[model samples]
Target: MSDAEGSNEITTIENPYAYLERDFSSENFKIEVKNLPKFYGMNEFRKLLNEKLKLHSNKIKTTRKNSPYAFVCFRNEEDRENAINVLTNYKWKGYDLQILKAKPAPDPLVKKRKENAEDLHSNKKTKTEEVCSQEEKLKNSTIPYHNVEYDQQLKLKLEDIKKVLKKFGSELSRQNTELKNWIEKQKFLYDGLPCELLDIRFSDTTEGYRNKCEFTVGIDEDTNLPTVGFRIGSYVKGTTAVGPVDNLVHIPESMKVAVKIFQDYVRSSDLKVFDPEHHTGHFRQLMARSAQNQLMLVVGIHPQDLTDDQLSEFKTSIVEYFSVGKGTPAKVTSLYFQKIVKKNHRDDIVPTEHLWGDTHIYETIMGLKFKISPEAFFQINTKGAELLYKAAIELAEPSENATVLDVCCGTGTIGLCFANKCSQVLGIEVIPQAIVDAKENATLNSIENSDFFVGKAEDILGNICFKATGEDVIAVVDPPRAGLQKRAIFQIRKIPKINKVVYVSCNPMAALQNFVDFGRPESKKVHGVPLVPTKAVAVDMFPYTKHCELVICFERWDKISSKQLQSEELVS
Candidate 1:
């Protein structure tokens, strides 16, 4: 009797495959089953399957940990067929099991070689076709000015910006009501601009503007060499192979040279390149940070049972090769060696040891000196950040008697910039190291008006008490991509004295949600007050990407009423 047909009282069945069919396809000797419980080991699963099907398989291959599938190969087609016929829709550990014939796994090297050959052919064909098409178009067209193409490109970029703004519910100013009405009448431009809109500023330097790059260390598929570059796919996708990046337009020449040097050193050394699958090997990643003419290199490694002397030798070789010298291609100001064990290891938890030179690099933004630590967050594009900060400050418009509160202030760059104009600047950040760096930066610039605290803004901002001097308070919040917490928004609303708020957001979609929490009257309110968004501007901080830095100005409605009352009293 079949396992399912047998009575519950009968623990052992005489014939397990009595109801299963013996006619199995000759081609399908491998049975693949999915939705296997993650906690079940290979041996236990194999034993259980054999007991139910009354069939034995020599090979049972399980995928990586937490993978919900396993492949079982039978000696004969009949056994495989019987197993599938009986156990195809079987339930295992409360999950419906899906069984199919497994295909042969592709060879990575062969697949890579074929892809490269096809890419070469495709590139050649595309180039030839483009050349012929361009020549034909030039000969046939009456007007061949390059300005026409430039104008088209500009229009496309503007359309993209408008699409993002619409997604975030951004509205055009009332002053452009005529334009808005015209846009509404036309079907083609109906969704392009809403009744309210935002102003966008273009970037000065469009290419090679990235100041920081994190590269993975692995073997290149094309060249079969140890390379330091970006991964072709993620670990979850099962394609952790990395490709060499020799001419990435986003990074500067100095960074590229530094990457090449590190790649060469890793190739020549006895150290093994990290493989994300097995999680073995020595070298894992290389993070390069550039500011002005100096470079800071942080090397991540998995020191697998290495001696102290061996580690010392490795560090010495890195220092001797990449350190600043007469013949070096890049000026490496700081070198850090970080030991990482897990794929998702936190930088704060896993300490980074300073190997050579200075521990921090100095970057000047808006005439203020800021110290950047290894793990501290700083804007990638320094020049673009200058424009972003300027927009934030202008929107804030802090008076001489105003006190500026900078939230999520990484290294206190924004707060220090406001120190020259405001009476006092208070900065808060969650990262402890970032707070330390911010304090040091304030001291470096000799700006004593700024005070930085280290904690989550939502938890700490509520308990902190402001001075009783009755100074006008303006908050400049520059949150990360995930945006601010709702409690943080509540705390901001609780502060009745705060009048104007300048919100600098790297991710506009998330920021829009925060605005809803603070602006909508139907939603939760703090102290029965809501903020109204007045003005907004978008600065292109990340060029050649779909991301932009957005700054929005919000004012308390009650404060505006109080200001109007004071103005009437002054007139009387």
Candidate 2:
């Protein structure tokens, strides 16, 4: 008798078709079950199917930890079809099972056995292979450190920075100066750290700290519906499937709410979600930024093959829905529609059109009100950015007689922060719009000691460096994750008046070569004397993620070495 037909006392029952040979390798015999609840174990899952639903499967394969999908192999196509019909939309453990016919792939245990067999005859795998294996294990994960504890995550990030610094130290040692000895001594004393490492500073709140989030518009893997969320994996990894952001811990609830409302709006709209592979459809990405309970939503769309009137109607519908319709609950202060078209030429640029509400969002950091445009580069974490800037300023130690040269300054946040402590603040940025915001921010704060300039730092740094009034100049270089360009680094080194540079990097690993360039000996390509790193500290800007802001202090070593010699002589 079937499990459902038999009494509860019959715990074990032999399959009536045990004598019948079956081909489990065929696709008809396999069913993929998605949206598996995390609370259920393998044994519980088997019991739920065999006893609760009276479904029999020859083999069941569960995914690794934290994965939400599994596979079940039945004896025949008839049983597989029955299992799929019974399990689809079946509620268990608070999740409705999304069942689909799964394609045949090598089983995990069988694949492992084959790999082990091959390894017996082959030598040990290379380090690159091992790293690739580890990366493959996390290919399905969006947030790499979501499962790791917060404290342990911070330690891992600190170790990452130390490794980068050690590489920098090794390159610096080749210069064969007194700095080399200093680096060696520091490495010996501090366990591979090039300088004194301070305790990491944490954000005020770790959970839901992100003020800015960019969600993709695509098909969700679990529901197979057009969803607004982050991608499950990168496009390079052959997975463009989007997953809901309700599970991500870094996004603030305000942003999540906006995403939900927008998702509903898009699902009801006639337009289709943008397909990155085909470059078709209308909706592309949704960017939400929140501050003080106010949200700024930028709807990204690929206007492909739509007429002017159709586009206008689409825009009107969105504005009306966000203004008076269902999106009213989101408290959207700024609404923007961005036409996301790829560049056809080198100078081509697509500007975001402001639809309704405010044009800029206001964020108050360190008691200063700064205007953030749709495309402006602002820190994702507000409170954590305050800590990062504080560490940078402390490392800089700008005196009242000093001038702060904020290189690659975004919206003048860093420059204005230093304006109160220094005599003058000259901010240089590449984007003209950001410079406009920066100037307005300087005026908004009502501080006259700061000024913002537009143009690339390499082209404008020399012109702006001589405009400083103070005797001492401190350069604060906070470039993008790609780090400062080679020419920009050369410009900073060429500026003899700038005695100290406080480098704030969100990606220290990518900025390794930039640091090496700064400390390298003077050459034709890299002019001026080399700068030596004195101290460095880390600020935990993004919690539950493998990212942090690194603030490093670089000063003219000739002067520092002279002072050290004088102190040593006095001590002797």
Candidate 3:
């Protein structure tokens, strides 16, 4: 039969497979194919299916321009099954085609209505619980700590850390079993090294270890009075009532006193607590940062249609309460009035107006002074951060002639730590203010061999054209919780000079994927090289919480070519 005739015959063939009545719906019979060639149009994809797999499609749907996938609907399940059986793992245009049955799209209005109903129900339940809890706590009025219970909580946190690390190690082993076995067989730096189950770095002052707290400004559930604290639950989880943190064990005594004083001041004033649900009111949130006996306060207010004079009056009232009050328990080092939009809680792009006091606060880590802006990212546990940075620097093993590259170097804390040991340090960060802080920090510490650039790790690392200054170059990456991007991995691999990589990750589960991207042989094809994991250690950055930091050292398998190495030696 002619090809055209065969296509017509296949299109008209009867589907004899038994299918559910629901399968008659177009959604049930549709299959989505992803990772198709970007250049493939709907007609071209359909023709390919027909010519290659001899399967007919009733209708073909293409995504927007330049999309890499399309949808194919068959008349019955038999043809869909055949298509999946034939094309699920088939390579097309140098990429594996991913085919899956499309899930039914829900009606937007129906989904929204259901969500709203659920939210209403949850809010009511949460409010009732919060009221009961608040009444009970108020009646008791005593904050006591039980050693047994505290020990149990600490034990549980350690167990959680172990489980997370175990899972992370298992995932790495699974992804690169050969590498794991090779490290075990060979005398790697970490092979046979004593692996501590959990290293306890006791906080110098456990009661007030938290240097910062963000308290929501709302009415107390029991008293119906304006107060400052955390909400009973999340706003989306149906919690509208604010719970007092006066007796919260983690907060400092000074912070508790400041919060209580602020609550009283707000209650006496005409300001209204911002309602997240209704998106109304004025005072939204109180962000307090404490460092070395000084406090920085950022009062997030809506400033809804308030005149400059009115805003000035409000600011004056706050200053008087905190600074000039009869019995002020806390010294206000810096105060900021941040105008916040109710809907954009995650937006840090908005600027904060300076109201009073110093513009920045200084925190000393490992004898290095770091100037922190209100918007700058700093490790909350100051003492714990020292341990974390020490672990990363130790694993980095920066030689006297080595140049260290610090990726996502927030405030250049890690880079500054190793600046004295290394020949030179180069830091990259996305935030411009963070870069400024990093430079300031380097200068404050009198570390003259360090430089910081304001750009993403992926962008800057990809375009890095400089040669290594010494025998070996080391990279220390402290990426955010989302972990390193694929492009960042590609860039890291492209730099033949950087043989050792010290990855400091806050989230190991997310970092596991990055490990796979860095060390797996499959990734070598894209980047032309792969790194081998040498050693990893977990630091208890957050003792009470389930979070911890992992530091892994990866070494490149392929060194620079002979001529490049000779040239690098000569240059050094």
Candidate 4:
């Protein structure tokens, strides 16, 4: 169920079939019972389900994000799952369905459970306790010692590590060894920013990596400081460069081997690897890649091969991202050969998308390109995205005359989904390339009533010249990992005509923080204050992984009063 759909009081269900019999058409809602078992054939299943639905007024409101179990609200629990018998070994949809006789409302303790889940140390102590026990045994045990003072020495080493991390601007909370074991890093970045010569920065030790490692530095032909696996960077900050994302900083051995293999394989007499200047080859490669990719998309031919289109495509298709090969210069043109090979580096961390081949990017109804960057956000699962869009549409059944604002509109997906159902749609984003792609996608879709702008949502949104009143406007925001920036939330909180907000986020922590920012009592969030959500549902986007996407709908309790708006700061 949606988090905020606190209908601790669901009393009615409106059946669409009855409405259709009364002359209205059943259009938006439909259901399909999946892969039912042979025992309860479709006929019996349908009959049984129909009887169950009848008790619930012939309607079953689904749980938030289409959870696995149906949140069927029967008048009484006794009849909800009265299978032929409790002992009957029957299955539906190829899976056993367990009917839970749950309280009408979720456990009041759920809020507390969520809080407990937030604590990192609740489960951390087990590891820490283990570490302590190991240390104690180290000094007392009689096992032969290559180093009898290993425990003391390790403690000193850990202290040194603390100093190193501190130098690099990191504060490390003591790792609980009792609950865990060996520690190591694949590589760390200076300034915590990824560098021309930076590598992975890991936490607790995992398979394949149980100790510290080192790297050897060398210049490649292109001369860009390829942060190859030769030498591992340290977590100590200010050592070279600093960055915001610094938790990981160790280069794994696989990366080193990969780098060596790449250097050795391309330099054979039969193959020519391009070797440009020493200082700027990497940056040039970076630039050339961007420009060449843009060109490639436009003409569908990469610049690596000056050969005929088919030949060139074939040649570049294999190692395009691994490494660049020397280009052959012809009378009329030049070709560069760089073979980018795919290899596993620091096991857990490696670039996954588009590195090997073409990635299928989603498009808006208007055909704008949803420009996805190597590191940028794109919905990973496909079928899941369609379901999410449908849910959003149901929430925003836009009338023909409505105006919709799509904020942080990645690839312009949301706006395009609503384009045909609305009069005017506007999308806002900060990435220039993504905006360009979004525009392209819009044009591709042949959607005529849409426009997009590039900038922070709050700043650009407040300045949009279009008049918003008298227009049925709905604002849909799908933000990044960090969730909606405070300024954007404040702006959204004060939107004049938009009375509803569909807040989508990949991070629940940030989402909750943003919600508090808008709905909390003292933050001048009065306009945002009314966004008491009617529902919040979590979608399992990453099956087998912990990550989940949350969709929250907040309906305004009241429109912005004069006092809330008069002194409200304009979004930055």
lDDT of each: 0.70, 0.81, 0.71, 0.42
Per-residue lDDT of model 1, residues 451-473, tens digit only: 88989887887544275134588
Once superposed on the true structure, which residue ranges of model 4 sit more than 4 Å away at CA?
A: 1-376, 465-470, 522-529, 559-572
Instruction: Name the better of 1 and 3 by lDDT.
Output: 3
Q: Backbone clashes per model, in order?
A: 4, 0, 0, 65
TM-scores for candidates 1 onward, in order? 0.68, 0.75, 0.71, 0.40
Q: Tens digits of per-residue lDDT for model 3 on 63-168?
A: 5844787788776779999889888889987889999997644333334434565667777443333444673443232222322354554566556555654555
Candidate 4 displacement at residue 539 in angstroms: 1.9
Candidate 3 global CA lDDT score: 0.71
When sorted by lDDT, best at the front, the candidate numbers are: 2, 3, 1, 4
Query: Quick one: best TM-score, which candidate?
Result: 2
Q: What would the per-residue lDDT of candidate 4 be over residues 171-210, giving only the tens digit for each residue?
A: 1112212111111110132233111111111112222221
| Residue pair clashes in candidate 3 | none
Score candidate 2 by lDDT.
Answer: 0.81
Tens digit of per-residue lDDT, candidate 2, span 1-572: 67776853232212222212333133347888999987555656877888888898766877574369988887688998899889999998799989999876533333443455456559656332454332233332645787788889999998888888888898788754646877777788777777777788887598888888888899986588999987766654445678778767778888888899999999999999987644568888898988887799999887888999999998999999989999898889999998876422222236889999998888998999998888899999899989988998999999998999999998999999988899999999988889989999999999999888989898999999889996689999999987887778889888889999999999998888789878887777778877888889999998877888889999987877787679889999
Superposed model 2: Cα runs more than 4 Å off: 1-140, 175-178, 343-349
